[model samples]
Target: MVRAGFYLLAIMGFSVSGALGADAVERAVASCWACHGAGAAPKDPTMPIIQGQQAAYLEKQLDAFRSGKREDQIMSSMAESIPARENARAAAMIAALAWPKVAGAATAPAPDSAIACQSCHGADFTGGPGPEGVAPRLAGQFAQYLEARMGAFSRGEIASAATMTAMMKALDADERAKLAKYLSGL
Candidate 1:
């Protein structure tokens, strides 16, 4: 009888903990929908679409934001809201979501400079395993957001991405803009 009671209590404990974990994960990702949109694209063109991004890339960015390696007031605070233990879970959840359709110019011819980007961001810029790590998908991302990020890298504002900083610095502003435009139309 004692063993039976103990087993029942153990099962109940596990069930409760599992439910709590689910709730915590939900809470952690709830804020993302505000800026990232419920199921579609973000309301602001400046916000990069996070849905369907590589889970590893998303997790890495979350860690960077939490550690201040990546600079962004809103992102820093938002990253903090997700408990460190749940970061990977949150990223996986987001990555599992379908990539939202973005209305934009049709796919443009790739510029010569784009060859360098393909080395890390995949041949199609849909992202995959790379020399540095898992690269985020740039295909169909916001042109404005990409240009701004590229500029920031060139200025060395994003201290977390040393390789990106060097590559961006090599390109002039016009070249960066062209690359961003081309990538966004993919």
Candidate 2:
């Protein structure tokens, strides 16, 4: 009730703190920074950098976790704790930040296995439009993290996105690793 009311107040241009005040909402979202990191960068390579992600994508993923459509025990519990109405607010704040970049990241030529990925992930592998939804930028992400995620998709551990699972499963471990290495370096 309070969350919605506050948003309503902000929307009405009666924001208490300032013209763009969101201190209360930011406080509520503080827990997200625990695993995601104090800054836009994730502390762990395995953790996806949520900053600068498309707002629609973030909102969709959050809703999926909250609704159990996506099976992430950690994220599900976290999502549950937030009032349903706050999901949009949280997504908006996170998505508005800058995307993290890896300085001097290794770059490699795209392997044959990565050809199909470009159709969605973009020619630069930064991300692009697709039939399903917006693909995330994988250019500066960690190779180990990408490999692990591909492995999870192949094993159905991450079943929230079916296309990824299918694509990961189509390639053997070596191919996936090669693609991950190539994509991560860019």
State which candidate has the highest TM-score.
1
TM-score of each predicted structure versus truth = 0.91, 0.76
TM-score of 1: 0.91
Window of ten residues with lowest summed lDDT in model 2: 15-24
Model 2 spans with C-alpha error above 4 angstroms: 1-24, 159-162
Q: Encode model 1's per-residue lDDT on 1-186: one tens digit a residue.
A: 999999999999999998988898789798798998788889898888999999999999999999988878999999998877888999999999998878655676677899988889999899989887888899999889999999998988877657888999999999988898889898
- What is the TM-score of candidate 2? 0.76
Q: lDDT tens digits, residues 87-161, model 2?
A: 888888887888776555677777887878888778877675677687777777778878887898898887666
- lDDT at 118 for candidate 1? 87
lDDT of each prediction vs. the true structure?
A: 0.89, 0.77
